[model samples]
Target: MKVEKNISLLPYNTFGIDAKADLFIEYYSLDELRQVLKEHKGERILHIGQGSNLLFTRDFNGIILHSGMARARFLDDETVEAQNGLRLDDLIAQLTDMCYCGMEKLSLIPGEVGASAVQNVGAYGVEAKDVILRVNTLDVETLEERVFTNEECRFGYRDSAFKHELKGKYIVTSVVYRVKPGDATKTREEIIETRNGKLPKIGEVGSAGSFFMNPFVPEEQANALLAQYPDMPHFETPQGVKIPAAWLIEQCGWKGKTLGGAQVWPKQALVIVNANHATAEDIIALAAHISQSVKEKFNITIIPEVNYI
Candidate 1:
């Protein structure tokens, strides 16, 4: 484990923003994590994995904790236990090759295992919460280890308890996922093709996948909008009617638009890319502008899916 001071966050976040962390620490084992937590009891901390789905808005005035552990083991023919720091795609590849079913739809999604349960990461109609059997965590306040079943995680659309009511209360250590032995090759290929068509390649462009969550609106509001835009795509959810944020952004005339190094990707309006050497402020400003335009045009508010640190 290494402890460093004033480390650049550019390498730690997907946005490529050159923010700094006051202190940066890495732990390779549970004992090392406990040691750091015990010694730095009251210090502010932010945990990270692969630096995906987040934007560092400014130099963090706290410690950034990262776990170095990465491992995955099959508990049986149909279940797997994976350590938190494992690259999500690596795990998916291994399981798919093993003929593990149901995970193929999530192939190539960015981020790590630890974030799966926290973000309830979803794509192509499948969500992490759907496969998660349980999540293992260490309670930072009491240094006690605990487990939460899928039901206890309070899984919702692109949300989980870890992100809301239980935010910052626990540090995820591992996750147990349920899988099956079946051919997943065809489905995986299709999902990949669909994503590649709309999303930028990871290293080729700087982005956090979808920048905005699809906004849900009441039936009346959706019907009103549909009257004007009969072709506007939507899905009905228990919350309300889910409106595609991409369509709204496109209607506001933001596709491929640029501002201060940030640009709405030409291929996908839901994505905001670091077109140049974008400062954190540049991305923030561009996002704000896009959001404002959508609000004015549709009378609907779209929330950011990316975490701002």
Candidate 2:
């Protein structure tokens, strides 16, 4: 266990907000994590992986626990297990290079392996839930270990039991994934090229990827919007029709719109970039502005996918 005081969180979070945590601790193994839980029994803790899907609204007044485990091993020819702290993209690269086929579409998504399960991160029709075999975790309060089957996670669109019924109750330690054997190098290259075209380069702009979940509305409501705008794009889900937030934001004329130092990414309206050292307040204000506009125009509520701290 390594504990630091009053740590600057700018490099830790993808948003690049310079928020400070009252205390920051990192552990490398499950045993160490158990010790941490035992020691900081009553301290408020925010457990994170890479902090890619998080936005710090203000300096955190509690301890922030992170994992430093990146070791991985194969259970078999088709099954691989990785510690929670491994960068998600790094794991993907290794799998693809070894000719694994299942993770190609999800390549380059910013986050760590543990977050992949927590958020059910997805892209190009593949979600982490699809390939996950098992999740290993420890109860925060009891420091007891439990293994959750994939079905137990109860993954939904950008959500899982971890974000709801089980929120703050467990710390994910590692994950096991079942993958197929085949080369996907070409697919990975194409995905990288496409992402580069749509998203800002990592060092160039700071963002939390897509800012909002595509709002799902009933068929009738979706039809009404399509009646108004014939060219709008949508997809059908089991629950309802999902509307593209970018299309709605663009229609509202918010593309490239600025609030303080935040701007809607010109290339992708769904992303809010730190255009000029934007504070967390700036991003929050801009997000509110965008949400309000979309509501007024389409009568739908688009909620943020990013976890605000």
Candidates' lDDT values, in order?
A: 0.91, 0.91
Global local distance difference test of model 2: 0.91
After superposition, candidate 1 runs with Cα above 4 Å error:
none
**What TM-score, computed on C-alpha atoms, does each candidate reach?**
0.98, 0.98
lDDT of 2 by residue, 1-309 (tens): 789999999878888899999999999888899888888888889998888889999999988999999977899998999889998889999999888889888999988898999999999999999999999989998889899999999999999999998999988889999899998999999998999899977767889999999888999998988898889899999979988889999999999999999999999999999999999999999999999989998888999999999
Residue pairs whose backbone atoms clash in candidate 2 = 99-182
Q: What is the number of backbone collisions in each predicted candidate, taken in the order shown?
A: 0, 1
Clashes of 2: 1
Candidate 1 residue-wise lDDT, 1-309, digit = tens = 989999998788777888899999999999999999999989899999988899998889999999898999988877799999998888998888888887778899998999988989998889998899999999998889999999999999889999987888899999999998899988888888888888988777889889999999999999999999999999999999999899999999999999999999999999999889998899999999999989888989999999998
